[model samples]
Target: MNELAAQIGVEVEPDYRADESDPAQSRYVFSYTVTVHNRSTREIQLLSRYWKITQGNGKVQEVRGNGVVGKQPAIAAGHSFRYTSRAVLASPVGVMQGSYGCTDLASQEAFEVTIEPFRLATPNQVH
Candidate 1:
């Protein structure tokens, strides 16, 4: 875990592989597993998510939506939730970063939880 990961109380682990469907296109598919923990005493409701996805060609896409996977997770103190998502990039190298909008159930006030940027690369780009 790193500092950014610690700030969000979440850990992002990425697993990427070459896209067999289009080997010559340089496209790669990546899946990230996010584990978020509620460290506060109050229950937190994840209301929305914002993501910035960049392709190898320098094109960027921003996605904002209500919750993930069509479900809002209410996490209690010391509890955690996890979700898996996929992304496709034009090149084997790119990154994804985002934040989660969460509200304290007790206060009804919302705050953004940062989701650290994670890399997507092929075996040759590992170094």
Candidate 2:
């Protein structure tokens, strides 16, 4: 695909670490590893990120940051950037969705690439 096509791919692996989670106190800690792949034909630099995190209790949190894990990675054409991040929630089950702010190196145009919504649930918390 082309830059104007703006096709970026994302993969997320979310895990619930019971050792670090205190479900009894409503504090759940989850870590997710994201693999961002550049499916388009142009190189792109990740500028920023915006995340919409929702707790099972219905509370929503907006996280705006400069980059993923302190680095704004540049994904060359047909390449990928992978990073791991963590999140804390007030409930056992929650959902996170957002996008990455990126710029096309060839045209200097900016775009938002979607990070598909993923679930964060402690084991046995959801059936």
lDDT of 2 by residue, 9-42 (tens): 8899999978898878988999999999888778
Worst 10 residues of 1 by lDDT: 1-10
lDDT of 1 by residue, 1-127 (tens): 3322233487888888544425487667888888998877678899999999987668898999999888899988788999998877777777889899888788787788888787776667853
- Top model by TM-score, which number? 2
Tell me each candidate's TM-score.
0.86, 0.93
Candidate 1 deviant stretches above 4 angstroms: 1-8, 19-21
Q: lDDT, candidate 1, residue 98?
A: 88
> CA lDDT, every prediction?
0.79, 0.88
How does residue 110 of candidate 1 score in lDDT? 74
What lDDT score is found at residue 16 in candidate 1? 80
lDDT for position 84 in model 2: 89
Clashes of each: 0, 0
